[model samples]
Target chain A: MASDDTPAIRLAGLRKRYGTGDAAVDALKGVDMTVHAGEVVGLIGPSGSGKTTLLKCLGAVIEPTGGRMELAGEAIYDAERGGWQVGDLRALRRDRIGFVFQAPYLIPFLDVTDNVALLPMLAGVANGAARKRALALLTALDVAHRAGAQVSQLSGGEQQRVAIARALANRAPVILADEPTAPLDSERALTVVRILNEMAVQYRTAIIVVTHDEKIIPTFRRIYHIRDGVTHEEAGEGRPV
Target chain B: MAGVYRGMVDDGQVLIDNSGADLWVVQQGTLGPYAEPSSIRDDVWRGIAGIHGVAETGNAAYLTMQIKQGGHEARVMVVGIEVDRPGRPGAPPYLTFGRPILQGHYEAIADEKTGLKLGERVRIRRHEYVVVGLTRRMVSSSGDPMIFVPLKDAQEIQFLKDNDALINERARTAANPAFNRPGVPGLLEAAQASATQARNVNAVLVRLAPDVDPDTVAGEIRRWKRLTAYTRAQMEDILVAKLIATSAKQIGMFLVILSVVTAAIVAFIIYTMTLAKVREIAVLKLIGAKNRTIAAMILQQALGLGLIGFLVGRVAAGLWGPAFPKYVLLVPGDALRGFAIVMAICALASLVAIRAALRIDPAEAIGG
Candidate 1:
């Protein structure tokens, strides 16, 4: 587990604007946020509320217009520099961040085990070791019996579990899950939230889940709500899954 | 197409290789009997034999004509060699059936490709000859199968005219006033007899002694005997570069066009396949997959498709090769070169797909 004082992710006065000259639109306005180790938080927002823009900035898929951002105790982006602190955002994303989409979106060609093993493989782990790590994660997620099955053979809930397994395959410091339970039933949705909370504590990783699912909303200890282009942090009910 | 050209080019070489001779002596100012008509006196081999470094010499007559058998007719190059002695330079290199021509006048050894059965009677200009033996791989520069007969019969067939033409020529000779002078005695009869008889052969095949240079002997033949002589390599050049140069060029143009079309097709297919996976590619990029990883995936697929195409093409060619009118020479060197070219083309074709995959924005994987 990480030391108590260190944060897994931090952002201060992050701003992003699209285009320029009279046509510019600010997607994120002075967004300030922080996520600590071994924590699971919720992010709820209305349509076009800069929720996706904030996630993109955090995932390193897009550069912020202005901001000071830190990940895993290291400064990554700053407004004064007007750019990223690191040279290769791709490497940072691969080594330090994980993501889960609304859809499971597992690679169809790869079997379940390879779907998880692929991250470590990309990180240059030997095939044997990568597969072993993938098997352990599958077992932890309770989908180990389907490890050798094709993605198409997996059910919706099973596929989501496999996706979570893949996100944790590299043991990244932070995970940004966008609507991780949008298609699940109430029972399955709570199960997914429970698994996410368990994974966060077990791996000492911070997880920020973006969702509109009312069924899984009360499971977070804290929630960040965004409107227009700004975010407001608040305490959650912290209901046990 | 290239195989057929190779076969035509090799036809001339096949002839030279079969003869096993070091030099070919023909009439002055000619490219030898195979490329042009060159009729030298039948006894020229005697003078060539007397040359230093010359081990042996044999007379060879090549006459390409249509021969009739039963109700079928086939064009064949009738080669007249010394049948009295076996294993001569002009003889068929090997016989697949029956015996060599023991009685020279009406017996022949025909290449198997001619479709002539043993003991089948084939009518030439004015004589009926029986096929006594069968050989293989003996063909003319134009890919016509060869029919090996005695040197005497080939000369007769090459020089003799039909009976009507012969009669007309005798009468024309007798009526010429210069020969029919009042007291010419037997001069008219002698002239007719001389005109009817043929005393020329096409060329002479020359074999040199060990440690002798073929070019040196060819130089001596050209300088002393006043005859055109060609070494093996020079003859090959005339046959390959001169005889089939135009056809080779045409085949080369066809191959270039074929390669372009194949590359275009491969590129389009790979590009389409890559485009079909746009969403998957976006997801991969979002997950931090390298650009090279996506590129390698498309490239490997293209190469695999090319390998399958090559295997199917090779099998089809092999199955239909013998059915072609000309021999199709499918050598291992050509097959290997073709495989390498296909792989190169496949790799090049995948570049477009790789570029498109690289351009996919990782942000697309997340909704706005």
Candidate 2:
């Protein structure tokens, strides 16, 4: 029995080192952060900082050398074990975590509906149920009209919306977005930010957006500035959508 | 029916010659003139006729010779048939033009493949004969053309020696004390005379009555005559299984090499297609697609390519098989077996692509 106030995602002293000995590079010395449910935080940094590394650690794409990570009140990694606690990391990523890349990266052979439905399918949901869930997400993201179209047939903004729909399909507890709006114009970028904020609150999902784009920087209510493989939290303007 | 022989009996109605003949006597396991010649005396036919279940019999001689025509020599199998009787066992089944040989000597009927026109002179041994008829597909088992000649003429041409060789042989015999003794002067002459005469034929072809059993007759011939006799089935086995065994082995080796080349080509093509989609594969892995799913996709694509190739190959073979010089037997069983083999090869070929795809790291999808 966990309390209602438990954070959606929490990291305490997350460390990742690339190699050993004097030639080794420490990508993330120790990253500590927390985001509650229904919160959207911005992870901003310079080029050589550990923004990408921290996002990868949270997304479970790469293993952190030493860390304690918690998702929805469960400890997924502990520094004492030196690895993830889950038996199958891939299943954890499929069922609990969502990712949005700089590029849409939708599978070219599938239509928009299939692209969004794939996440639920991978988690062993039936085909009809998965497609229904995908359709509901597309409706929420305002891309339902293009659900039957091929990924190549969609415009840039439409592709981004579809990608967002995919990220929200499985109702994951957390979403790690790596520069999701970098390729869009200023107006389109703000629209994407507003959509992300709405979806976060609507689904009660905690999202961390890693970006260097100046257009949507002020949209975040809380911002973590990482430099020299470390993070410092600061409050944003908290502008209204 | 195209290569098999059918000849007219005394009634002038054509029937398969093997069906008309109850038993055939030849050297054991020899079916064509390409092998060493075997002969039995003409008197043996008399012994064969007296056997039970034996009805009527004819004598035939086989010899492969080089026939000179238009200043070019061609190898042909000369068959000696009885010119004294019409519809003899050794006669050509049918003729397309001209007439059968009416004279006992100095006349011949040739297969169309011999390229002999009517009234053209062909020299065999020390004699010349005019071609009187042309037959189609009257070839020996090994596809050599057949030339029909009178029995006595064929025996002489096959056995007679040249004048110089004969003289030398006689002098050599005379110098040997065992054969040239003055006490047995007539003995040497008797031997010389016997050597000049042709008293033997290669085999006796026997024809039975309508109600007779050929297997029983063949058994009696072998028992009483003390010679090898063959029923049609036995002869077919000897010709197809024993005589052509080496040729079958050669064809089997060719098929093995072709299968290996097909496997290699399929592996290369599948590997190239898999390489083209490496980025997509990494993304799929990052998105939690299992390794088996990716492998199955590649395997199915490879099998599809093989199916397309097999269909095209089968159609091409069907269209061009008749144009080849030798017979090309393409049966449905062979095609089905070939399809199975192609599918198995394609499945095995996709393994290389699968191994490469499984090694892709999912983290590569994220930069750095």
Candidate 3:
């Protein structure tokens, strides 16, 4: 469960470095950001600006050099705790955080419903209940009619919608979207952003969208512009979809 | 190839089982009658029968040669058995059609594999014999079908020379000073007759009385009669362990090599299939799929492919087995063993792909 009183995602002094000594390179110098529950914020950056690194760090896919991260009201990573406070990062990611990639990246072997249901199944939910949850999300995303279809049979926009449903299937408090609408046209990209907003408000989740696509930039209530290894917050137009 | 070798081994066992003998008395100091040649005087059976523990004795001759039938030639093993009694040793255990040899000389009982029909005439050397009966599973150690003929005919066919060679031999004998001496009367003719006649058989099959130990009788024959006697167990060893040992070893090596090649092919296929799904695997990991889960997916795929392959191979072998020149015996035990081996190979082969999939970075799905 998420609430506006406690932010779903919070980071302070997050840092990441690659290699050592003479070949050492700092990917994320220091980052500070927060997004309350039921909000979708945009992250825009050029190449080599550390957006993907930050996303990886938040997704618990990579270890941070130094950071304090609290998700779903639990401090998962703190430098003073000598790294991660969570014992199992895989379970932590599975239960609390969801990710939507640049491409749909659905498991092609599974049909559309199963692709969404697999997350809950991996978390030990019963198969019937997991499929019921997946079907509910697919209905919310307006792709319920294709629940029995394979991933390859779906159109591009339909596949992306299914990916969104999959990310929201576990009822995770935090959803991280990395260029999720990059492959879509203007109308589809805006549609993807509108769906993200509706899903965030409906599920009470904090969403962060990192994209180079300018088509959906104005839809965010706020934006974070990252340069080199640092992030700067700015006020967005917050235009209506 | 291993199947054929197994069939050959089984063929040898069938012949031994059909003989229904407790002991095989071969020539002294020789491994014979099936894997090697042996020749003892035709009267050796009479001496063997007189032994205390011996219940009965029968003489048998075995020779392999091409027989012509209906303008076609097929190599077969000619087996000579005594036709004087119904239940003699070295007789075909059972007849599938017609009757056993009645008159003895020109009547032959042929294995159905020889393609000889009842009453068909086949030429064995200088004699054309009528096929009087047909038997099944009667084959030599080398997988050639067996044609049962009378002892006299088999011996003559095995030892008798052609007309020109016989005449040359008689003339040569008449010109010899040793046989044609002035004081000699019928000596040259006796010598010629002895030279031309075949008075030897391959071996003597001995049947022992009930509750009598074959080893004891065999030991007595070897000691007093000065003949090499093989008990049923020893004969089986001679057939399975010695007769076809080299061929079995060669076939075993071929099977090992084929298994390795099949493993390599399966490994390559699984690896290629894994590489094709790199993105999907990465996404699975990115979404918190456990290593065991992904590994199981790959393993299941490999095992499925192996199952399909095994079924297809079994069907193909069943379809083509009968067309081979030799017997291709497919045992249920062998099929079960083959299925287990295929699944084991497939499981082991998928390790490479499983390792590759495990090493894939979940970040690859998100991209830089």
Task: Estimate the TM-score for candidate 3.
Answer: 0.92
lDDT of 2 by residue, A49-125 (tens): 98878877887878899979999889888878767888888888777888777878887778999999988998899
In CAPRI terms, where does candidate 2 land?
acceptable
Give the interface RMSD of each candidate. Answer: 1.0, 1.5, 1.1
Candidate with maximal TM-score:
3
Write the residue-wise lDDT of candidate 3 on B1-368 in tens digits.
Answer: 65677787888889899997889999998888897889999998888898898998889999999877778889999999999986799999899999989987999999999999999989888889999999999999888999999999999999889999999999999999998887979999999999999989999999899999999999999998999999999999999999889988998998899889988999999999999988888888888899999999999999999999999989988999888887888888889999999999999999999999999988777755
Query: Which of the two, 1 or 2, has more DockQ?
Result: 1
Residue lDDT tens for model 2, B1-368 = 11111110110111124224557776554552223366877678788888777777777888887777788888888888778866666678678999988998999999887889999988888888889999876666555678889988888877778889788888877777777778876988877776677877887888777788889888887676767787766655555556555656666677788788888999999999888878667767766788887898789889999999999988887887655444455767778888999999999989999999899877766653
Q: Kindly list the per-residue Cα lDDT of model 1 for residues B242-335, writing each as its tens digit.
A: 9888889999899999999999999999999988888778878887799998898889989998999899989988999999888999887888
The regions of model 2 sitting more than 4 angstroms off are A1-6, A35-48, A80-82, A102-118, A131-169, A178-223, A234-241, B1-23, B28-50, B55-227, B232-236
Candidate 2: lDDT over CA atoms? 0.80
| Deviation in Å, model 1, residue B116 alpha carbon | 3.0
Candidate 2 at B200: error in angstroms? Answer: 7.1
Overall local distance difference test of candidate 3: 0.91
Clashing pairs in 1: none
DockQ for all models, in order?
Answer: 0.55, 0.40, 0.67
- C-alpha RMSD for every candidate: 3.6, 7.0, 2.7
